[model samples]
Target: MNPALQGLLTIIIGVGGCVGYFYFSNQFLDKVLFPASGPNAGKNINRANIIRPWLFLLPALLALGVYLAYPVVETLRLSLTERLPDGGSAFVGLDNYEQMLDEPKFWEALKNNMLWLLIVPALSTAFGLLAAQLSDRVFWGNLAKSLIFMPMAISFVGAAVIWKLVYDARPIDQDQIGVLNALYIFFGGDSPNNWLTIPFWNNILLMIVLVWIQTGFAMVILSAALRGIPEETVEAAIIDGASPFQVFFKIKVPQIMGTIVVVWTTITITVLKVFDIVFAMTNGQWETQVLANYMYDKLFRSHDWGVGSASAMIIMLLVMPILIWNVYNARKEMQ
Candidate 1:
């Protein structure tokens, strides 16, 4: 078949299949469900009423099941087996989980993940809130916001490389190479330090990379949320003698609590799954490993599929609740 005709046929069939499914499902629901459950027991029925909205929903539901639900199930199943070197394997029920629990590297990665979870979201949201509040009053606020948000446009690997140069170091005898170390030397510091080799602090340094990338996202969303806050509410608070700080705390924060949660949760999820920066900069070497990088090490570097899948499952398990809460909160807000 000609490519154009094939494409046309595919679209026609796709639309026909969707229309057919929605028409049948809507009929089934109205006949079986509404008669028994809905208040309209004796209402007139029409095909237009039955299938109008579901026509749009059919494609989305199908895509969700195909792209999201099926892969999750496959990943869960993959988590339970070990793949061997000679293309052979055996079932290992929780053995991978046991190994992961016993590994120091896994624990370190988990610890770093915890640190990321604690630090990045809080810092990003705090800084975003402050930026939002400050920008609200500035004359050229849009320009300032554009500048602040520009970092978010850089790829994670690019950002990591940029920061890598900033954190780069030279021997104390020689000139300090890294921007940070150079700044220190300029300030009369004695020696240059290897920033990435520093434990715990290195984790914080890695987190600053994420915060740099995500703060712009947080700022954009939060600034919009702040702008959405009604002038009447601020005026009312002022009329009742609320100080600026008091009004901000009691009124503004409470009003945008949903957006705050959203920003925090979004960054938290990103932090949990972070791999690119760590891999690009540290390659999970030194003390800079995170959960996603840990999983990558097991899956690819070590060829330990079971352990990798298990860690992937763990990440999914950690993220599912936040995702569920996000959905619930969004629904509640919409209602």
Candidate 2:
């Protein structure tokens, strides 16, 4: 079968099925369940109207249940069960969690994730705010914003590949191709250093990649938030003898603090789920393990599904609070 033809047929069938289902369901609801030709027609019509929205929402709800809710429940179940030699499993509650907790690598991954949580969101948000402010002041602000926000378009792995080259190293005798080592040699440093192998510093270096990508996202959001600030407030502050810095910090920043928190939590969620850059650049070597990559290593490399699922649950637990907070803030803003 032709691939394009198959795709077209799939699309046609999907659309046809949806249209047919909705048409028939509404017919059943109107003619059979709530016939308009009866004594209770008005009540039936009212009830049908009430249920109509749910009919529209049913497909999406079912999708979320199947795709989103199912995996979480299955992962939790897997986390609680141990695999047996006969391809069966035994329930071993908390044993996987205990083993994961006891592993030094798991602790290292957790520590690194904490470090990422602390550093990446803060730096990304700060840099984004700074860029937003500075770009607005410049004559070529849009162009500047475009350049700064460009990294957001790149995939994490692609950005890792790019920065990987920037941090690449070679022997002293050969010409340095990496931007960092070239500058190092230009400044008369003796040997080229492998920037991704320096343990704690390597973690910082990997974080810079994420920060670079996320800063663009932060900038775009914070920029809109900054623009949404009332000009009257700025003018009033300036007229009241507030210095530019004071006006920005005291007036503008306070107005956008909600946005700032949203951006911070948004990036924090991304940080907790971070895996690609670490996997691509260092593969969690040099004591730079993160929970997602550590889970991947366990689930795939070591074939340890129970422990892997346990780690996954841990990541979900860590992310849930911030997720809830973010949702709360969003609802408050809507109200």
For all predictions, the C-alpha RMSD in Å is 6.0, 1.8
Residues 151-252, model 2: lDDT tens digits: 999999999999999999999999988999999999989899998998899999999999999999999999999999989999999999999999989999
Candidate 2 Cα outliers beyond 4 Å, as residue runs: 1-5, 327-335
* Model 1 Cα shift for residue 210 (angstroms): 0.8
User: Each model's TM-score?
Assistant: 0.80, 0.94
TM-score computed on alpha carbons, candidate 2: 0.94
> Number of backbone collisions per candidate, in order?
0, 0
Which number leads on TM-score? 2
- Candidate 2, lDDT over the whole model: 0.95
lDDT of 1 by residue, 307-333 (tens): 898898989998989888878877998
Report the number of the highest-lDDT candidate.
2
Clashing pairs in 2: none
The weakest ten consecutive residues by lDDT in model 1 span 36-45
